[model samples]
Target chain A: MENRTIKMTTPLTKEKIKDLNIGDIIELSGVIYTARDAAHNRIKENYENNRKQPIELEYQIIFYVGPTPAKPGKVIGSAAPTTSARMDKYVEMMLKQGITGMIGKGERADYVAELCREYGACYFLSIGGASAMIANQIKDVEVVAYEDLGTESIKRLKVEDLRLIVGIDSKGRTFQEEQVKKYKISK
Target chain B: MTRIMSTEDLIPVIAKLCMDACYHLSDNVIGALKAAYEKEESPYGRDTLKLLLDNAELASKEEMPVCHDTGMAVVMMEIGEQVSWVGKPLEEAVNDGVRKGYTEGYLRKSVYLDPLNRVNSGDNTPCVLHTEIVTGDKVKITVLPKGGGSENMGTFTNLVPADGVEGVKEFVLKSVLAAGGKACPPIVVGVGIGGTMDKTTLIAKKALLRPIGNRNPNQYYKELEEELLEEINKFGIGPLGMGGRVTALDVHIEYYPCHITSLPVAVNLQCHSVRQATIEL
Candidate 1:
């Protein structure tokens, strides 16, 4: 792994993401949108509706989190990432909408991993329980849409030094899947 | 005699207990993480361990809670055999403490009153309170804040005696693999074997309170713990399952004799931040 920071745009390319590996530590300095169960469903519904003017999503990263409400003087309260498996069902939908990367904890389902490989996307696992540590990296946050959803509402987060690992790379190689094989010892 | 504790007397103490436990990782847990950091072979796992230590430091300095899930208040009490009181009921006193702790400490209220409705408990109260009467004259209070991620993945199996230790090892590994990164890697696994179904579950949960990295008293159980740890790490679950050899920090097993036909086993997994505290009043 060379010490070169590649400045890539969203709708990430297969060639660019392919170079990433399981141990490659990188700072995600980009526009990552926030969404969880509710927001994922809403986006799916919009696609089904064939809504005339749909939100453009070609190279966006969706962060799986439901942050606590911001205290009066704070930007957010303990904004940690939730378990990623919960969003397995909605990955394909979001990926189709041009989601190139995902940041969350845990592993994706087999189908989700397959879709990620098919679509040239990647999955990055952040440090769980380090919400306050991660929260320090966010430069700003705003509710771009879905204010009614409260904590689950969709928001745009401007972040820096948001450390993450390539849990699943673009070449369809997943550390998570490999882990199962490595550890499942046959009696 | 039914001794009573007033809301004022109980709330502050409970609030302080919660805040203290949330902000600071206990010495035993920290020691385990330190040891895990040293022993972790994967670069990614080592990095994750660094981040964990950093998080703990930041939490202490910034006065921030360790994890977002400060967890539901679980009060384990051993009331004194002698003492009389007048004030609020025990439940009310505990609830008052929960309310103040959550509200004042700025901790998240992660509990839902009704499992079905999913309505917020508001204060994280109506705690999972359990009490026992003992021969002592003082009250012994133990606060164990069980996080949802690990709690969600806990499993219990009532095995047949024929299955033996091998069965216990398989169930624990399977549960850990199934959990993956959900419970937060570098986990502390608690195994309870030989008790009945519910008893085993309790044993597993209580086992978490033991100092991390410390082996069980029984020599057989201690060796089993080492074997299980080696097997779990081989999975390369690493830190947060990013790929490495440090899947679990330690495997702590607590066991008791069971019926001739029953080989009950339970697995209570815990994340890096194993938060717990106790007070003898």
Candidate 2:
């Protein structure tokens, strides 16, 4: 019914992530990592290869995006959010890596929500097709890892007032679960 | 007497049409979004609609394509039965249009030659062109640029006639709900029912070409569209599918009589940036 201003510090921790609720609209501020279908796979592969440690996520929001290459003198191109369901497979990997939140569009699978409950993480929906507008919120951008994937590559971004809505929260509520309850008529 | 359209003459028209559709949301689509926005009870859904409208205006003045996807070019041609092609051939002419439009407008080249290798097709050539012959003196061309996000969520199903209206409604709702925010709601759902498998799918896509807020000409189809729209909005997929009353802006259904045994249905979920324009020559 009402909105309150709060700062979302990146590299977030369990203690910090426990207080958020479902249906909250967050104006996220601080560092976040970007990845999508490909980068998520690569991160999983690094873990599979036992390559030191896969993404040491903490208090971080993973933005699911594969942006177009930046134009001349721009920090990024039209960087819109991709569908999040594609990253459903990597949620466990991310949760184990201690990711506290995610920023993307669309629904996460049921298993992903369970993992969020177990791991004290939350998922939020960023405005789809609003990449250029969202990009204006970014203060800095850098390649965190996996630079070879180009747009799909992992990048660390400094952002402020990046808007998102909680789709799944630590309390274990999800839009999918809610809708399935509302719509499932019978067997 | 057939008139040959020079490639040069056709290219600019296509180029301008493409640019115009990308920056400006068609009036019908705008009307649909506004209606959905006003009816939407969720604050987020309403804000999303405002963002979309604002995006449309900013894209126009700044000349940025509405959504970065820009999409693959789909050309629908109603060629006059009397007309014959000349010059560089029809396909080549269409490609030339894509080349000029994508290059000049600075649209993203999302087309790839090899699906697996992912090689950009340079100029976005080999457009998806669907042609039809109709009794007329003038040629009509309509371009519907389909973005990848929504295109990826399209689904097809073959059903028995026994499934009937309930079957049609179930398939439509399932497809949209499964797509959720992936298709970027509030979406416009295009449902094609009753034709053979392929035609059914084609009809679903063709349904999207119908102007926004326009119901099917068939009275039965019009009723079905209204019912489906109500059911879909009830899902609360909202704008961007984050839970709201405007999951779907409209439902456009096109049906064809089929063999008694078949009830093929296809759901083509078109994202809010439904960019389309037609040229009559």
Candidate 3:
């Protein structure tokens, strides 16, 4: 597929991502929230139990990450996307809570794709293991909630030109499925 | 006569190894990634490979971790049979080293205190240490910081003797395909054949320590490794499973004799950021 690079800003809405397709590269800017397994579980628990959430989720982007602690003079440490599949169970919950975009690495489950289509949400993939390079793109970070979770704390991050790929579009088409079909050698 | 060694002496060495392994991409992994970039057919795959290369360079230069998942410390120690330890217990020293390394180095503390409790250990402590008594007089220490993503993709199975080589190949391929982008493709595959079930899994993990492009000394296993590498890449999972020419950098197979009725096999995968460091003391 001939992929096109698009620049996007956070506080994304349905209109912003409705046209995004698999394989399109995105250079995203503005603010994003970081969460991983621990934070996700807590978020789900809070929502189900009618507890107050630490951060407002509506119209925001969530990046699945657990960054290293920054050294003496850095905005953040090696910050990169962790696997998204582990967060599959929480996808529908977050989307229902009004998160317009999710950024992570790897393929998601079939139900996640369906939920994205239903909720007009998009799943973006950052380069897995490209932590140092990704870290350079983050302009600022602050632990917004769950600080006791350590690396898994939910952090508010202001990023500049963070690179990402449209892994699964709002329409449920996935780059992984398309690429595998196109390239898998039938032997 | 046995040589007396102090457990305290290992603390600094192990600490440094942990930091060094996280910060620097091993030479072999870097070389393979460069080669993968050169040959990758997909634009997305090539771009991802380039980013990884740049990430490695920046990580080493800036003394930062290559990935956010600093990983659980898997320390393999080959202790000389003739050596006697003094000071604190060996495991205690190792844990201390891990604690100092993760805290001082600013790497992520990824280990949990208990499997069910789900609380962070806070120090990345109580690392998984595997020690073997060897004939040599010098102790060899190797630390492999195993990321949860690739480690989660590992699989083991016991096939009947009749299933043979083809079954092992099929199992490995299936595991890799199932892992897809999750394990972070362009991975290093480690296969262990024969031995008992537990031994097979252990050898499978140990097989990952072998340098990329290095083959097993045995002719048959070497050939199997070559064939597996070729086939896995053909799956077109590519650099980050976006599709391309290289899915796996190399395949290393380690085997041992097993009971006549058993054909046990295990597969372990290492992501592109293959972080391992070895030292002899």
Q: For each candidate, report its DockQ versus the true two-chain complex.
A: 0.45, 0.34, 0.79
Off by over 4 Å in 1: A1-23, A41-58, A69-72, A144-150, A178-187, B1-4, B83-85
Residue pairs whose backbone atoms clash in candidate 1: A10-A59, A11-A59, A183-B235, B3-B85, B4-B85
For residues A63-180, what per-residue lDDT tens digits would candidate 2 score against the true structure?
Answer: 9876654556777656667778888988888777767888888777778888888988889877788755776677788887876555666888888888776778887788545643
lDDT tens readout by residue for model 1, B219-255: 9989999999988888777777766667888899999
Q: What is the C-alpha lDDT of each candidate?
A: 0.77, 0.78, 0.92
Kindly give the stretch of ten consecutive residues in candidate 1 chain A with the minimal lDDT sum: A1-10
Give a tens-digit lDDT track for model 1, residues A17-104. 8777654566777677888776787888888898631345777788887664455677766667778888998888788777888888
Residue-wise C-alpha lDDT for candidate 2, range B27-143, written one tens digit per residue: 787787778778877666678888887777666666666776678888888888877666777777788887788777766666778888765676667689898999966788888
Clashing pairs in 2: A11-A58, A11-A59, A12-A58, A12-A59, A12-A60, B185-B240
Docking quality of model 1: it rates as acceptable
Q: Interface RMSD value for candidate 2, one decimal? A: 3.5
Interface RMSD to the true structure, each candidate: 3.0, 3.5, 1.2
Q: Stretches of candidate 2 above 4 Å error?
A: A1-3, A52-59, A69-74, A142-150, A175-187, B117-125
Model 2 chain A — which ten-residue stretch has the worst lDDT?
A: A178-187
What TM-score describes the B chain of model 3?
A: 0.99
What lDDT is reached at residue A126 by model 2?
A: 79
